[model samples]
Target: MIRIACLIVMMMAGMLRAEVDARPDARVAARDAAQRLDAAARQMDKATTAKDRVKALSETVHAYEDGLDAMRDGLRRATVQEQRISRELKAREIEISRLLGVLQSIGAAPAPATLLHPDGPVGTARAGMVLADIMPGVNSEAASLRAQFEEVTTLRLLQKSATETLQKGLVGAQEARTALSQAVADRTDLPRRFTADPVRTAILIASTETLEGFASGLSQITDAEGGAPLPDISHRQGTLPLPVQGQVLRRAGEADAAGIQRPGIVMATRPQALVTTPTAATIRYRGPLLDYGNVMILEPQTGLLLVLAGLDVVYGHAGEVLPAGAPVGLMAGDPALSGEILQETPAGMGIGSGNRRSETLYIEIRQDNTPVDPELWFETDKDD
Candidate 1:
């Protein structure tokens, strides 16, 4: 009877051991699948271009899903191993206890030598020997458990890495999509076209010359602090340095009285107003050119360039330095005739009248050849 029982126990242990051994194979398969999935996801994230981005995102999602599935399978196998180990441990404990009880009942102390001796019935002796052999096998199962634990840890790490990588890829794709969409929207809403006014141009020319003179006078008073005379460009913002202030007949870079392409700011004032220099600088260029009639370019310092146009007369010559607010020139013709001669004169003449009755001053500020919008730099209120 004992022999039969021992055989049955041995068979059960053998079956349990077989199951544990099989678990490692399953765990390894799961680990491999997870690693592969993670690798594929990472590869997809590195793809460039729109098509590549789409492909990469797709691949990443697929890999992530596959990895998750593998991880789940791995965990299930680990659970099975844990259960097997638990059952085996309980059976081993029971066998150990039974052996100890038998030794105690026989008035014998439990010892390795006693366990190995074949003095008892064959079946009982075999059971004792088998228990000793199984003890080492239980430790082997512990190693397998440790391996399973390691697999779980590795799988979790892979899952986290893949997830983070996928998220970053998704974010990048979304941003690219947004930028592309915005570009399309901007293309559809083009800026409106604006016609220029020849009359406004004439006014700007007349006022520009008058302002240059005032700038020259100011330069003379303040020349002690500077190297050269003030440039034709006025430093004052908003109102010009002229005594007879006029309304802004037409805006710069906008539709004017006569249809023409105007590229700069225009300030209208009395035609009789004196032209003044704004800053202490030398006159660099003075002549009729393009939209600027009777133009005068002045260099105040090293980099500052002032341009005065549409003048009755240019007092300063090229390379000649003048004081700030000094009288550089006068607006051409009488103040009242600005409107009558609007059509009779040339394209850039100092005569214009359409929207408002006033002399126009064309002023531009340039730093290193770059034309900065004077409206932003100039103060809108009265100048100091």
Candidate 2:
């Protein structure tokens, strides 16, 4: 019994003395994102061609987005973990105190006294066996408590240092956006399907009152239909990627704040988020349209039009044919300068419920000038 008690004491002491140097999984993820951002930045600096620079800058923007997301998620998880550990520790205070007292008493007693009980040798032998059986359980509990304490300390440290990481990620994202804009301006290798007839486009714009009318008259704005045949994407009908990284904010035919229903889906995205072409297609029209803000209309297939609106800066001309994953435009809003935006939660909510995504992108798919569900064509599943 004395030996068993000594074993438990040693196990607890060893656990308490052990330091937890390993970071939490969340913190590790954040660091990995940071490394990706650094790599993308270096790639941009070493790029030898305009194409390479644009690709590098796009990667840099994506890396920063991923990094900032990691930081927010890590901060939230740390806060929850710390709170849970604190609650468990506080709730088990009485039990822990009793266990500690019993251990102290056992250590204080002499070996001879412990071995010889008032009920004689048989009683002492039974006590020894019982102690031996319960030793493992006691050791397990001690180990758990020690781990919780270490985790609490680590979580607190992570929360305290998150600000610096978040700030750096924001700054890196802003720089990448600026560089990408310049690279896109200097790019001139993209193929053109046909030269746009500006006179007809201006006339059409002045006469049209609806998106349907504008789309129906798109052929009039193009000088000719002759160009290299676009690759057949009939087999990839349901597998195309979304133009931007975001979460579905509203589905097709969903009403807005003013109860006005639209035949398109809305996506919640991060500020200055890059919007790309899901497939190689001709730029039908790109500029300010009625009330949809700056829009980019893509003709991936004959009679099929994909409309993307709510962008701040639109790229490409009306006739330029862009390749898949090409930069089309960026979402509105400046990059956050601090971590305070990440920590801002809704009323009566905790830190984990907060988000920095403040921009929305509107998407629509039209077939033969008729609006269809955008989700039917674009993959809407996002990790966020």
**What TM-score, computed on C-alpha atoms, does each candidate reach?**
0.31, 0.81
Model 2 residue runs over 4 Å out of place are: 1-24, 48-51, 109-122, 160-163, 195-203, 224-226, 229-232, 337-355, 382-384
lDDT of 1 by residue, 1-384 (tens): 234334434444455456555656544755575575556545544543334343344334334434533544444444444445555555666554554454354345456554544556785578677666655554454454455446545544443443344344334333433333333233322221122233544444455554334333322222223333333344454443321134444444677667763544676654444456655556655556445566666665555556667765555444445445544555555533322322232211122223233456676666555555555444443231
All models: lDDT?
0.47, 0.75
- Cα RMSD, each candidate: 31.1, 5.4
Clashing pairs in 2: none
RMSD of 2: 5.4
lDDT of 2 by residue, 1-384 (tens): 445555555544433334223334656654665566566556556543544677667766776676677776766666665665677667758667766766677779998977786779898888888777766667666676777788777776776666566676677677778888888898888778888888888899899898888889887778766787766676787799999988899888889999988899899887788999999899999999888899999999888889999999998888888878888999998666224443433311136354656789999888878998887887766334
Candidate 1 has a TM-score of 0.31
How far off is residue 173 in model 1, in Å? 72
lDDT, candidate 1, equals: 0.47
lDDT of 1 at 382: 28
